[model samples]
Target: MELLVIVGVFFLLCAVFFIRTVSKKKAVDKAVDVDKDDSYAFEAIGALFTAAERSFYGVLTQSLKDNYVLLGKVRVADIIKPQGNLNRSEWQTAFNQISRKHIDFVICDKDNLSILCAIELNDSSHNKADRAQRDAFLSRALSSANIPFVEFTAKRSYVIRDIQNELHQFLAQQSSQTPSADTKICPCCSSQLVERVSKRGKNQGNTFWGCSAYPKCRYVEES
Candidate 1:
């Protein structure tokens, strides 16, 4: 009888201990659930431009306000399109290339926002051969579209008068030369073909009909 009594007491104690442990586990799980709910968050960041880029962007904006609208960090794909006889895979590749590249600034018409010129600020990094090659590629792309392209060395201050004079000269030159209507259109993108002047290698200074959507559409024809 004593043994039976002790066994009953032990079972009761075991049951109580099991219940307490389950209750504690449930409480812990509830606390963890609350923590998870509060965990997701984000914070504010500073300006996207560097000190030099910001200063030049301000100058460029102010200088262009009168005649042209200035757009910063414009994507190459936005201003240009791919046009040519391209298969589906080739078309995708062209679009991917243009999507990866960007122009620093684009000057557009105040009335219609048509791109007038593209500008690249050449910092010390641009002195590297790779950067120079990239710059040359961008220059050719703009030229092929009959859009004026200009490069400026980054500085703390800029002469607005010099910028205005250079733009005037480029606009005047563009007005003299026009893209031929008979040039073939790119199958990938409908943009027209414009004559581009070669700036490097053995074909330096030679003109060719290149798709307006340069890096995006690389179709070229001899002029």
Candidate 2:
């Protein structure tokens, strides 16, 4: 009976030791997990702060529009129109010539009959010799096309207000120089028709020119 009692005492002691060791291990693991979570939280907060700083400066410096903010206001169709980026390829094909380079912004009046001005924003990276050569080539092309162009730098902190003022001034000057209307001759029937809007699709209320001959002369020009 004494031997059995001794065996029971030994087993109880072993269990107590095992429980204490497991508890200690669990406490250490919990502390490590807490530290890891804290570190990740700090990193996420730091990234958020950095992104906020960039966005604030972009708004102040007008770089947002120069980069991609203008896309929000302008439709993709407008951007790809013949007066804008699409003019590059159209002009090349029309003249049977290819340009060595291309211009960035092509601002025009409401009618889009003539290009009023072009604006190019350059960054510090574009200050390199190669980029300067490209700019020079694009400038020559603009000159050949009888278009005026301006270059600005974002690194110099050109603000949004500054760009707005410049654009307003240029538009005012262009309006004074351009004629009120262009000579329009109908392509289908050679008739003198007035500009009108299409009464179809989402553009039902939008401006477009149509033939006065109605069903007989089906002609349209977008305004």
Candidate whose TM-score is highest: 1
Per-residue lDDT for 131-196 in model 1, tens only? 999888888776665567899999868998887786764333221133466646656666556666
Error of 2 at 222 (Å): 33
Query: Per-residue alpha-carbon lDDT of model 2 for 1-223, expressed as tens digits?
Result: 9999999999999999999999999999999888778555433444422333344345434632332222111221232222345567685563342222344455554332234446665667678999898678556555444345567665533467766666553344232232346645568865444454333457866766654333246577876
Query: In terms of TM-score, how similar is model 2 to the real structure?
Result: 0.34
TM-scores for every predicted model: 0.57, 0.34
Candidate 1 lDDT (Cα, whole model)? 0.73
Query: Please, what is the whole-model Cα lDDT of each candidate in the order they appear?
Result: 0.73, 0.51
Worst 10 residues of 2 by lDDT: 67-76
